[model samples]
Target: MRAIATPGGLPISDPAALVDVEVEAPQALPHDLVVRVEAVSVNPVDSKVRLSANPSDTPRILGYDAAGTVTAVGQEVSGFAVGDEVYYAGAIDRPGSNADYQAVDHRIAAHKPTTLSFADAAALPLTALTAMEALEDLFHVGANSEGTLLVLGGAGGVGSIMIQLAKRLTSLRVIATASRPETAAWAREMGADEVANHHDLGAEVLRIVPEGVDYVLSTHSEGQIGAFAEIVKPLGHIAAIDDGNLNLSPLKPKRISWHWEFMFSRSLFQTPDIAVQGRMLADLATMVDAGEIRTTATQYIEDFTAAGIREAHRRIESHGTQGKIVVTR
Candidate 1:
């Protein structure tokens, strides 16, 4: 199998940061599906791992989002077959989807939406899963939920899908934060009821919702902890996906319920409800087919070579990309 991998932690500008290699195709485990990968998307985690990973004799494959066809199925796999087309954010512990073939747990993979091409479907898994888990599991939002929800980093991959999911699945009035004019328009296109400039987050959001929002989903929660505390309503829930040295004392006075949402948690821990990812993805497919949601793939590269992969990573590292960037074979 042909794959792109990082030799070790190196700068993206370095040619050795990502290289092409030939390796044996992976085989399916008892509950796994061996997929023939067709397309993949690059996320922030890819760059983080590439930079932070220690140097090793063996190169590490580093893709999480993939859309592919199942070429073989493990003995215990039930919902998927050899010919099924699937999409998933493969477990972080295993070799990732930046290869010709990938072995993924069937419990976390779902049939790709029939309405989308492989490139488009590839863009959804990781971001969609993050948004879905943050809203449904962490925040406990549903159809009857009526409140103003604020989304930070609203034009990024996860936030793009988050806005659409909130609008389609729940009655929550969504206020998304985007600093630039283009990003604000993109957020509105994704179904955000209002767009606030993240540069002045507290003031911008408070201007729109004077009483403060009922929930906050912080996609890029680096230095905005204090702003989140000031803008969110008392007793409201706050969910964050990013990791940093957070000073959480500000939210303590308001009794705010803080939640950390990591989409890989269930698969990483082999949780009892790990299969929920597959089920939720299936439901998302139904929604996609029904036109309730749209793919967030804003940038597409037809080349799937190492250079192409490197360019995708560079774009993600640029920190200015809107929505997802996909690379197809």
Candidate 2:
């Protein structure tokens, strides 16, 4: 099987950082699906792993988001079959989706949306799963929930889906943060009720919701923990995906509840309820088919070459892309 991998951790700017290689095809485990990968999407996790995690003697594959057709299934796999088309963000502990074939746990894989192409479907899994878990699991948001929610990094891949899910699935008044006009417009296009500049987030949000937002989901909450504390309402829920040293001192008075949403958590740990991710993807597919949600694939890499993968990583690391980037074979 043809694949892309990194032999050692190196900066993205290194000309030889990512390379093409030929590797053995993966076989299905007892509960796995061996997928013939057609398309893969790049995310921030790819770059982070590439830069930080040391690769084994066999080069390490770095993609997590993929849409493909199941070529074979393990004995215990029940929800999917050999001919099924599926999309999933593979477990971080396993070899990734950047290859011609990958073995994914069927519990976290769902049938691809019929309305979308392989590339478009590939773009949704990782980001959509993260967004869904953040809102529905960590924040406990429901269709009847009523509150003002602020989303940081509103136009990025996860935030793009977050905006849509909040609008379509819940009654939360959505406010998103984007620094540029184009990104702000994109957030609004994704169904955000309002968009504010992240650079002046406190003021921008305060101007619109004077009492402060009831919930804050900071997708890239690295240095703005204090800023979030200042803008969130008392007893509100604050969730984030980024890992950093956070000081909860300021939020004590407000009684804020902090949560972290790592989409890979269930699969990474082989949790008993890992199948929930597959079920959520199925739900997302229904919403997409019903026209309540849209694909976030704004950037497309025409070919699945090594150079193309490098370019996709560059765009994701730049942190300026408005939506997801997909590379197709």
Which one wins on TM-score? Answer: 1
Q: TM-score of every model?
A: 0.99, 0.98
Candidate 2 residues lying further than 4 Å off, grouped into runs, are none
**Best candidate (score: lDDT):** 1
* Angstrom error at residue 68, model 1: 0.8
- Candidate 1: RMSD over Cα atoms? 0.7
For residues 146-223, what per-residue lDDT tens digits would candidate 2 score against the true structure? 999999999999899999999988899999999889999999999999988888788889999988999888877766
Give the whole-model CA lDDT for all candidates, comma-separated: 0.92, 0.90
The residue-level lDDT of candidate 2 at 125 comes to 95
> Distance from true position, residue 236, model 2, in Å?
0.5
- State candidate 2's TM-score: 0.98
CA shift of 281, model 2, Å: 0.4
